[model samples]
Target chain A: MISDSPLLKLALTFGALSLVSVGGAPAMMPEIHRLSVEVNPWLSNAGFARDFALSQTAPGPNFMMISLVGWRVAGFAGLMAATLAAIIPSSIIALIVGRLYMRFSSQAWFPVVKDALPPIVLGLIVASGVVTAQAAVSDTLGFAIVIMSTTIVALTRQNPLVAIATGAIIGLAAGRLGYL
Target chain B: MEQSADSSKTASGRPLGKLELFTGFAEMGLFGFGGVATIARHIIVDKRRWMSEHDYAAVLGLGQILPGGNIINMTVMLGDRFHGPLGSIIALSGLMIMPIVILLGLTLVYDAYAANPDVRAATIGAGAAAAGLVIGMGLKMGRALRLHPIHLGFAVTTFVAMGVLRLPFIATIIVLAPLCIAATWWMRKR
Candidate 1:
């Protein structure tokens, strides 16, 4: 009775995150990872990793991972809760500040905040990469795929989906070969 | 961007309304693969002319450093610009319609076949690649920014706090954000 239901957890988690997701929702991925996989233990490493992959692979903003996580945890209700919670709070703030932003973009403080945030966001993004990698890699072949995929996508202008689809084929081959 | 003195207006120089916002954003939601930034710019500035290049840049620039997803913020801001509070709702609904539907469709398929061994293996593989994709994306951004020394210091600190030490995001960001902003202000003054 003390523990909250998964649906409640989904709402609470995303609602809180939506406000602080300053660097963007993807920047919140590490926190999401920690809560769902480590602290509260709602999803397994593989489950979270799969959801991250699907969310990224799907044709939408990077923020859609909330929907995938919700669906995995509690079906339709979870999906609605997580998506609405993740989106609404921040949208409200944006609505309030947006008018000011357009009018005052050239104001003294605007550029400083803009310049300052990127490095921090970049760091969070790197942390997210690390967290997702931990969830995804269970063996040498899997590890190798991550490294190679990172190299190819980072060094070139190639689309990221190339790396994803290639990894699937490699994994299928490796899995059949019993390497994984 | 060399875009000169153009006033903010749609392509036909007519005022934009909720209908335009909905359809425009719906198009972005449907085809904005990998991300929506590029597609959003193309649609708003080029195809729809809802906003000139200069105006789009100003709003989207502000959108980037603010909270939430960049496109979501852009839509909210742009919706308000074109209409009002209600425009925000319409534009957001436009953006989510196709994405939510497609995401749910994918979810159903995933649930139906997830128990299969082949599917499991592929999912694992795809997940690994996704992890790499994320890392690669971070690296790409790092390259683009050419990190100032101050910026690099903060980036390294943030990375260690989250990735190495596994500190909670809320407290760490609260502590670091002001420090980083102050450092930037100092640098700008110099």
Candidate 2:
């Protein structure tokens, strides 16, 4: 059998993710979750979910999931390569543009870049919401939770953590009762 | 920004040490799960207190508008805040390491049990929670936009057009953006 390098795979997945991860890491959720669970079978859906949760609960950006995906594929080496792959491309661009941005603070193009971005980002973020919803909400109880959460989110100004904790508790209780 | 120079100064005016960056990312990496934005918000405003809340909102708005990732923009901005170019690099590394490590572990378990039923159920549950989180975020963004009634009308219209009508991405951007901009310009003029 030919030796498959998980490290290389991890690098490639995130490298592509870097380029196509428009709007942010969550925007790529549908694709990345599909790739990780369905296409490559590198990580189980549950495992991916847990890793994602961990990534979310932690600090920093959403792109941290790439590291977990990479690490799952090939141990420590995979972890470094994936994290590097996920961050380096954007870092380089930001670094270069940051320098230029500082220099061109007074230029017209800066505002143009600014003006052109909001709608696109809005659309992408909306798409991300759809994609994440598709992967996450499954059963009746789960579906209700999603709708309730969405409604509460829209209607109330309560902190999101309270809502999340509430849903988690409900879900956990439902699981204990075999109602899920 | 108005803080005295001595308040921010350490032993020297040097950038953050490698250790600081590493530990910072690790803490965030380990605990920054759930909605990544919340973690991101904490880093920008609470932990580092780099930018004021208003500035954070402005930058976040701009980041959301641009292509690439919103969190990445925050990372860059925060990096710029703490240590300029070098600081940004450290910050990004600090944020990314933990997730990758976790993902790698998932890959191994996935390879072993791709068809497991319990795993499928867990994924489904998690996905629901994610939806809830997204809804929460959308509400937050909507509130922040503070559009006038007319602009809010546009936002709702646009949301329905894109969300329910399933318009193409470019189509939505092309159609709604100019209208919003024109409306905003007109509103400001009056």
Candidate 3:
């Protein structure tokens, strides 16, 4: 029988994540890197990096990294626990924060929060992309993928989903043909 | 902060309220597939007309820089803009609750089959779709910003630098954003 301990760990990490991560998931990159790679023996940095890339390219959210971590640590059960842990605490916080923000929204200081938010978020997104690219975009094949994806994104008005679908189809076909 | 948008009547000629904002956020949470930011823009600018595309871009730019979820940041920006602090809270709560519920549901299915080909295929498809959505949002941001040729040049150059030259994302943004902003301001003045 599989244990539930990893899942609990995920929940605790995620809860702590929501509270401390002022700069977003990328801001927590150092800590996550430390935990997943240094403190814990669950996975190598490269393995975690691969999962991070997959999650970034995958649908849903970056937090899905937790699921990948869970999978590495404890298989499918770990995945569920990690995924749940990532989702729940932030949700509850959102509920309470949302309620409280409503109560004091009109106060003068609130706008300050609004004003401070944008630059930080923008910086983090760029940082997140950089971190992903550092790990994922290696050599010619990876570079080609990044270039093609960016060009298609820049030039086309087609739904972005279609672009990703196209890439996956190619990846799958390549994999099937033993090219990957 | 403009008078028109702050006090403007929506296309439906209905004044939006706290409930509408909450419901809107809930809907976004539920159906916001593929690059949450893209879906976010749709809900805020296109569907709800809660804010203009430009405003959305500003807030999105800000949210992306902060920690946590970009969509959550957008929720806060919108909530604060429209209804003050309480609205931000309502919006954030609505956005988060849906996904937690969905993930919990996923846990049940996950337990049933660890190596389900269908689930694997779906996630792959979803991943590809997500990449596409982000590309789409980049396109949308390009249009919404109505950047000049120079600004466009800066964006394209950075994209190539980041995507091709494999330049660091933060470093490029740091170096280029000021140039872009300066050029934009110069162009606007002319």
Candidate 4:
């Protein structure tokens, strides 16, 4: 039903996500996944997973997934709508809040609000990780790739691009072996 | 510290030109593959000397608390700081324009190649790694918080509700966020 006018749907969905996307783009992954895959059926689970992967591989903000989803659903118009919708609302809010904060930075309530946000944001990020991991990992090799990549990223200050490249190679090999 | 001081000495000590703001953020947008936060810090505080480290941190903190992408929010704030609404618009354009074009091009290539077995496999692998990156980021952020017991409890509850139980994101945030804030406020008052 919502898919009928996918451009409008894409704009509204992404715009809504934009406002609530505390901690950044990744923080809103679960909702993005839910809206795109489950509610709207814009992308299948695997398709959404693939788009998510592509977003990470592409340069720029992780929020690029919104653009990819738009492109997949409705071409260039959809992409523009989704990207602009996802960015503009929050950007405006930030401008207003930034102005206000600059004026009232020393107020007592400011630090309290600041102190409270990190844990909640952390939780949201962890939830997003779980959602993506569930979508991506299925087999033993997939599990291994996830674990290895996690270890590499967690233990070392290495660029995450290395882990992504390594995972791609491993997956290619597994695919050649018909294990994937 | 030393690097920051040296950069400040060399800085032109003028409000950034609109073009300069655009180019600076555009560079960060282009090369900020995994994330732009660190690169933004380098440009804004360490290299450009536009803001002190303390000021940058404060702005970054505010960005995190607000909605949308952190870097985008930072750009908005930074741009406004120098040149108000028009400056903010330029900063956002500079940050998004090149990357949008590049991503669209990549999307076209991806769509064309998506049917291939190799492409499928590579995407799967990259997806898994991307998931890992998310987890790694969560772990790092979680560790950095050094959460108090109450904060940990809230974090765990949030994880369970949102991640494990698959609760609706908006509802969960609305319910949990204010509670967490009140808890912190109480903790601070004591």
DockQ of each: 0.62, 0.27, 0.16, 0.59
State the displacement of the C-alpha of residue B157, model 2, in Å, after optimal TM-score superposition. Answer: 12
**Cα lDDT listed for each candidate:** 0.84, 0.60, 0.55, 0.84
Model 2, stretches more than 4 Å misplaced? Answer: A1-4, A37-39, A43-51, A155-161, B1-68, B74-86, B96-124, B146-190
Error (Å) of candidate 2 at residue B62 is: 6.7
Which CAPRI tier for candidate 4?
Answer: medium
True contacts kept of each: 0.72, 0.30, 0.13, 0.71
Per-residue lDDT tens digits of candidate 1, residues B16-44? 86787899999999987777878889898
Which candidate number would show the highest DockQ if scored against the true structure?
1
Backbone clashes, each candidate: 1, 33, 23, 0
- Binned by DockQ into CAPRI classes (incorrect, acceptable, medium, high), candidate 1 is medium
lDDT of 1: 0.84
lDDT of 1 by residue, A1-180 (tens): 534788778888888988888778667788989888887667899888988888877777888888878877888898898899899998888887786663567689889998999999999998989889999998988898899889978998887789999899898887788766
lDDT of 2 by residue, B70-180 (tens): 667666655655566777777766766665555545555655664565544444454466566665666656566554577566656655664556554445556766676
Assess the local accuracy of residue B139 in candidate 1 as a C-alpha lDDT between 0 and 100.
Answer: 92
Candidate 2 local lDDT, residue A38 = 70
Identify the superior model by lDDT, candidate 1 or candidate 3. 1
- Model 3: residue B54 alpha-carbon error in angstroms: 7.9
Q: What is the DockQ of candidate 3?
A: 0.16
